[model samples]
Target: MRKFISRAAALLLAGVMTAAVAGCGKNSDSEAKDTAKKWTELDQTQITEAMGLGWNLGNQLEASSGGLPSETCWGNPEITKELIDTIKAQGFKTVRIPVSYLDMIGDGPDYKIDTDWLDRVQEVVDYVVNNDMFAIVNMHGDGYYTVDHSWLLCAEDDDKQTEIKDKYGKVWTQIADRFKDYDQHLIFESMNEEFNNDYGKPDEKAYDNINAYNQIFVDSVRATGSNNEKRWLLLPGWNTNIEYTAGDDYNFKIPTDKGCKADGKRIMISVHYYDPFNFTIDENKTAKTQWGKYAVKNYDNWGQEDYVDSQMALLNEKFVSQGYPVVIGEFGAQDKTEKFADYNEFRRYWSEYLIKAAKKNGVVCVYWDNGYNGNKGFGIINRFDYTITQPDLIAGMMRAINSTDDYEIPSPAGYTEVRKSAKAS
Candidate 1:
């Protein structure tokens, strides 16, 4: 499971980060000021294909407590360029860095991002782009659960909505300005998962506000000019859910980019897939451990291969078919390797099949690695050692990505009961 550091502990850590967090100096002069040089000539389809298989540097930069951001606050070591080099060596073509700028952001009207935090983020992005790989930097966790003055609330009180929008736009403006000169290799995602904090049916007003946020994000980034005017932007639907995003019910409008230099090809859709949460996450559940048709025991009856196909088809019909490429921003089954001896085998199967499905439907898939390497965790690589913890799973996924053969679902085997004590959350 992911670590949510206590506010007290975060406060203690914050004491050391005071200098870095408190400084709101002007942007550095090291940026490449050339806005005319074109880095990528690929259109949306080619750009999506270029992304290939992607990885998330999760739970690191996005880890925060009491509004203070710390890369190591959640038990992960400091991020090193070597860590990113290891990831690139493993065949990942893109790296998505989930970032949070809570207390790292100065008080409004400017909402200036702390200079140190912004530079640190740029340093990581450089690690990825230096390897000639696509890097996605996004506003993550600031829109998440109630904490750290998390203000990206789409369903804010009517009176407070202006403050939220103002903060959102100002923050994006600073982020865009900081990376304005970076090439097309650097992409900006509007927000991680901005919703009403409701898991039920989405609120129309909330959905409308999310659209407004996207528009603000697009306008704000474009206003920065430079390479950002044409930089590919990823937009998430309600909570980044496939159905809420592309399905008929919710309101998810793509932001209008009137002067986007990419010929209307700069916008991309972002959504996550964690269907049957009981299997992918929930540690309290004991039954849905193994997944897929061949799993004779401890598998979800639904969200099998057919469900994967249908969901991909939905995105293709609604988005991809119309020129907007859909990205499975996050998707993975957790490690229950200790709980079930054959768990990794099923994980390999799940990964392979999911990759095949995503590729078939013209979607890019980025695996979510939360940096934990045991039961209930979604890590595949040991971040500190830069070692592959789940070789078979990673291998299966790569094979699926490269394979052109038609994928066939395996026949279901007889069920076998396997139950374990639920771990306390």
Candidate 2:
């Protein structure tokens, strides 16, 4: 029988599973764990600073069709160590690998993840970690309503809570154990962009369920012991929206980590930035192509430089200032070169300024690359040949990452004071 199955039976018979045995797995590689933890005796700030700029291995491992996941399902080639090697060479110290189990997970109490799929994911993570880069593994598309067999639903009926929570615990239990021996370089993020589908005021019950999911994620991973006990975890708020996460209207709770010897010093808050969707993802509406304060035409009056400043500042005040580091897990604008003549220039400018803003506020930013190049895509490098498709854009971003001087945004063409009301606070 699987370890989780026996543990579940025991929990039912004993009425509860104690915290002491949550990480009741084997630690065959204790020596490695000790060495990895000892390699860096730094707090969250120093650790995050060491991470530098991050990039997402997006639309590949997270790709699914009819609920079945395949790395090539989304038209991207199989993930190669060479691809990660090139990424590391490009000055990215961290790689965020978004994943989804969906049909890859089994039914019932244990909810065993498919060994083949899990192993493949591990192989990719090793490619990054072995390259001396931080690897962030996360539960990616399991919560999306569009994905088939996605049971990690926060908006489901209350009667389904037991099954949902059980599966959640079992999934993370298996994942944590699989990578329990890994060092601090392997970070496990709770979930990606999860929340009630409602874009308006979030549902209270759904938000509460998200909190429960995060708590369960932390508890399950820590229970697995080994390096997981001290591993840095990335937790996302509702939809990973800056306003919803940090604003006073919605309550986003950080999970309690009694398992960590250093209180919650190992935890990091995650949020995404794609403000002014009109210019970021909405490629069909090409009128809002230009961005930043210096755009002469086709620009959004809101979500400009000031908007980015306000959002990053909110995260710094709420979390970063209080010990928890913030990660902008995914942020990038789609290619609009076909629509606008100098779209690439504006896009490069957007990335440069955003990196500077994140650096200014002491937040880590990861570019979202969906692995597709050309118009209407968020890709920066071609996954097939492992070449940098956006040379100027990537170069400017790297400069911003390493530069010591503050990158100041020039004032708008006709503006004096800032537009506070339109900003996303």
Candidate 3:
């Protein structure tokens, strides 16, 4: 009985000690988490910087383990014959795959992303580099993930932010190891659209976050122990908007790490153009409203050559002049146009303007054409028949890429209603 009593007393003492330590470590209501914890992926720095010919294939968002090929949505994969033929067939030598990695990884700080998901994503990237194309992959629409993590940057407690940094490290480690052996053509963008304005911190704080995030990304991918050491890296300015990075009001300081400076501008500053802005990006994404973006039958003096050129001039100054190649990573029309003729006409015009502007200013242009689930142009190829829309454009792109000289660029008005009507079905 006496021995039992002594054991009970020891157990009570141990409980008391545990509670004290936990209490001492407790964060104050106003204290934020810290970034003090270190991980290997947060330390390495293997990178490639260069002027790259690239395009972003939109609506290709996916979970880690790739899916069975959506007609226009994420998954499916970018390696099918149709995709390869279309991409390689075009003059494009590089492809940017923007992916959302949330569902694939749990919300936990040390979540282990599913390996199968990682493998599938890698396979598509392999196909791109293998074909002699520079492949740019990035964290797509991940703003949602960070938004939920506001505590990391906005919480009253510093300790929470540190924990958030820990989460970032864990996520990148999984990404880096997956594509470690890929070629230099395979570049990893740190993140897509670092938009967190609610933190109430100065814009500089956001910039600092970008630097820290890129460091983790570079360090994580380099740990894969292969050619990733020299693989190209892309740094986005704010939200990948041309106006944001290239406008007079926008001035983003580029980031460098571990004695590395920004690569004589090899880092491509990505931008998305859907000019006459409202027509292009309405949050109300319905087929009818989507078509509205292309319904402009009248362009007053503002849509004239001078005005368009003026806008593009800003882009050139901000990016091209900086010696860094820029890419219109995405641009496309939603199906808001009431008439198919309007759709085709607007498409043709938009395509012509965007393409020439890109070429003229020495930027690469890629359309965001994902018309999945009955939407238009999600996938260039008709999944059932395996045929492609805009065959002429793809064909022309190839010719341009291979030709010794520049081709005569066409205007949007020239395509006419016949082609639109013919291809309408």
Q: Estimate each model's TM-score.
A: 0.89, 0.88, 0.67
What are the clashing pairs of model 2? 22-223, 23-223, 23-224
Computed on alpha carbons, the lDDT of every model, listed in order, comes to: 0.78, 0.78, 0.49
Q: Give the TM-score of candidate 3.
A: 0.67
Ranking of all predicted structures according to lDDT, beginning with the best and ending with the worst: 2, 1, 3
Candidate 1: which pairs clash?
Answer: none
Query: How many residue pairs clash (N, CA or C atoms closer than 3 angstroms) in each of the candidate models, in the order given?
Result: 0, 3, 32
Query: In terms of TM-score, which candidate is stronger, 1 or 3?
Result: 1
Candidate 3 per-residue lDDT over residues 1-425, each given as its tens digit: 11111112223333433454000112232221121111112111122113233555554542222322222232233345457546665556667776666556666857776666565566666567557666677775444322222222322234655665677678777786555544455667766656454423236556556556666666665555544554455666655655556655544655543423223333556666665443343323322221212233433223333445665677677656766556666655443344344444454555555555556666666555542312233244543344665665454444433333356544334332333322342
**Candidate 3: worst 10 consecutive residues by lDDT?**
35-44
**Over the stretch 1-425, how does candidate 1's per-residue lDDT look in tens digits?**
11121222233234534534111124344335442354666787788889999999987898886678888876678999899998888888999998988888888788888888988888888788878899998998788765566878888777888988998999999888877777778889998877776778789999999999999999999999877878889999888888889988778899899758766678899998877676776566554777765566667767877798899889999999999988888888777767777777777777778888889999999998877777666777887788888877777877877778585533212323323321110
| Pick by lDDT: 2 or 3, better one | 2
How much lDDT does candidate 1 score? 0.78
Ranking of candidates on TM-score, top first: 1, 2, 3
TM-score, cand. 2: 0.88
